[model samples]
Target: MLEVNHISLTFNEGTPDEKKALQHIQLKLNKGDFVTVIGSNGAGKSTLMNIISGALFPDVGKVTINEKNVTLLQEFKRSNYIGRVFQDPMAGTSPTMTIEENLAMAYSRNKKRTLKLGVNKNRRAFFKSALATLHLGLEQRLNAKVGLLSGGERQALSLLMATFTEPDILLLDEHTAALDPSRAALITNLTKEVVEKTGLTTLMVTHNMQQALDLGNRLIMMDKGQIILDISGAEKQALTIEKLLHEFQRIRGEQMGDDRAILG
Candidate 1:
């Protein structure tokens, strides 16, 4: 359960370059609710994610997880209960660490540190089983450095690491946008599988309209620093690319200008 209440943020406030990234944005996610977010460039998609993840503090309002205020919480402090996968394949993983080592670190999240080794016989077995679910043969290369893997492989590993601890909230910021279509599809399916299996509450930001519609039980479209549309249940299920575009035009009184969103 997460709540973002009347949060607003602006950069370079009162200056020539001042821009409002978010304005009185409000969102709430029930337990196991999966919401897909869509928007054109500068529509505050990633900005909203950053606010939730504690990478950026809002100028007003507050964020709460399970009814506890965390607006001022540092990103590291929130990491214990939040799992995130960035658009970049390299962002979420350690390039120099072995596959097993990276997984070991994720497995240790929120646990008290001790003198014990991060990886052992039991942990390795668990990591192997987990990696096997990716179907990428990473379980057999547990000793290999992450940098040597392909982009898709690295992203898959990143997804696994993010979900390994079963954090209360999962934030995916265009996690598959960097990969080829085939690989993107792979990661997308994996995302659906993992979320359903773990019942993890998730918020995913994506430019692809089809992807926005295909995944999640709910969908929201944002523009000009505000959430323009939020649809769920039957309404979300009945949505099509044409209907979504029409809704945007109807709400904003203008055409969607982002070509990527239109073609996606």
Candidate 2:
């Protein structure tokens, strides 16, 4: 459903701070494929998501959704084709807006709009039903300020908000990294539910190796911006953290003892 072909990115070009963030990375996601991406820090995990979401441009590459080239598209233009939940909870939500009001914006994303800010009764019912999926009682708290929510609650709502329009691709950038373990687990499960129910193609960047193996239909490991490993189907089902770590060392020719991966 989505493809990244021959993409590379370099930051601070021509300066001492110059760093190559990605190196000819190529990847493809089939329809309904939940691909979990895992790697050590600086492995270009977030960079790949940024490129896909159009928050960052590639030095060279082509990004396509269903065969259409979106390489040169602006970030806002890409938003029409994609849904994203960032690492930061605040990034995806408006602090001042009430819960239902925030969703009203998302509901009207692709549709033409005027100054009609009031939520119709049917749309209100739809938002309530969607909020119920989060199991946070947000459906009953539609008038509450989003800023008053806890980290986990906010993240759950953010996930709901991102998938509100059901775009072509869903980019989850360590979405649960900010929540507590129990809350993270809840959101992770909710992630699977929403994606499966909506049939949304998803790319999830996670630091937890176990979560990577346990959640997605496919698995990918990266190091230094290059995709060094990819596995799916029965192969992915049989994967263990030990085996994944072993593969990283085998392909990247580096030690596989990153605490982020081992302990996460």
TM-score of structure candidate 1: 0.99
What is the C-alpha local distance difference test score of candidate 2?
Answer: 0.89
Candidate 1 local lDDT, residue 197: 97
Q: After superposition, how far is residue 29 of candidate 2 from its true place, in Å?
A: 1.1
lDDT of 1 by residue, 30-110 (tens): 999999999999999999999999999999989999999999999988988899999999898999999999999989877
Q: Using TM-score as the measure, which candidate wins? A: 1
lDDT of 2 by residue, 22-102 (tens): 999999899999999998899899999989988888999999988999998989877888888988988888989998888
When summed lDDT is taken over every stretch of 10 residues in candidate 1, the lowest stretch is 106-115
- After superposition, which runs of candidate 1 have C-alpha atoms over 4 Å from their true positions? none
Question: What's the lDDT of the predicted structure labeled candidate 1?
Answer: 0.95
